[model samples]
Target: MNLRFGLPQPLLSFTLLLVWLMLAGASAGNVVLGLVLAWLLPLFTQGFWPDNPAIHKPWKLVWYVLKVIVDIVVASITVARLVLSFRREPNSAFICYPLTLEHPLGITMLASTISLTPGTVSADISDDYKMLLIHALDVTDDEALMADIHKRYEKPLLELFS
Candidate 1:
């Protein structure tokens, strides 16, 4: 059979089913309904499906997610401490860091990961995709911050997406 959709139908169906079950709170009836919807919805929208690039290493993706969670927690605590300490810390400043990963998906993931963490926000990405401008809540060492972000988040993302 010449499937017009270039992606694997089974994987797409399974992903949709899982999403539906989670959204519906995993009730037995919802599970069955989700399965039906998952199958039918993909079949109906097959023409609209886009090609997904193959993931080279699934384990790296899992590790990246875990690291993000850990970073979020640690950053939250650190930010909270700074807020409560009543010290006259300097107002945050924007810092631009050079980036090497040119993949669009990798850049998007990097931006999201940085914004999701406490005390740091992704302000903008340069048009050329060569630099990422970030705002830090506490403007301490800019070099250290950039290095930490690259090492903790960007490097792992490179592994997963690039």
Candidate 2:
């Protein structure tokens, strides 16, 4: 690891400082506090990050984010419609989704994507990290849900992190 100005993770520190500034505004106190926190956080957490996550296809990340955003919007409408309707009940069910992506970061991204979509939450991951437990608000077709997730989210993540 290259240490610049006594900082182990310069990029992370810079990102943290930028986020702090954006959230707290550009006051003198905020600037000083943000700088201190940014510098200190990387130092404190350096040991926890065993390895830095690598992005094999940075372009895919942009596309993947866009897809997720679209899914979020669509799912939000579906969930809202289900909630407002009184005639039909949501067929809520727990799904044990089999995992294909092996990388921890990839699996984490997949889990996050599932949770980010409305009407679905990633409940837990198996100890061996081979399967994921997901809960959906409504499910007409279980197999279809799993397939869609695999094709849309997991496949891209697998490719991205490979």
TM-scores for every candidate against the unseen true structure: 0.73, 0.86
Least accurate 10 contiguous residues by lDDT in model 2? 47-56
lDDT of each: 0.84, 0.94
Clashes of 2: 0
What is the lDDT, from 0 to 100, of the residue 45 in candidate 1? 81
Best by TM-score: 2
Candidate 2 local lDDT, 3-79, one digit each (tens): 79999899999999999999999999999999999999999888887576788899999999999999999999999
Q: Rate residue 137 of model 2 by lDDT.
A: 93
Candidate 2 residues lying further than 4 Å off, grouped into runs, are: 2-6, 19-37
Q: Which segments of candidate 1 are over 4 A away from where they belong?
A: 1-50
lDDT of 1 by residue, 59-136 (tens): 998889998999899989988899988867756989998997877778888999999999889999999999999999
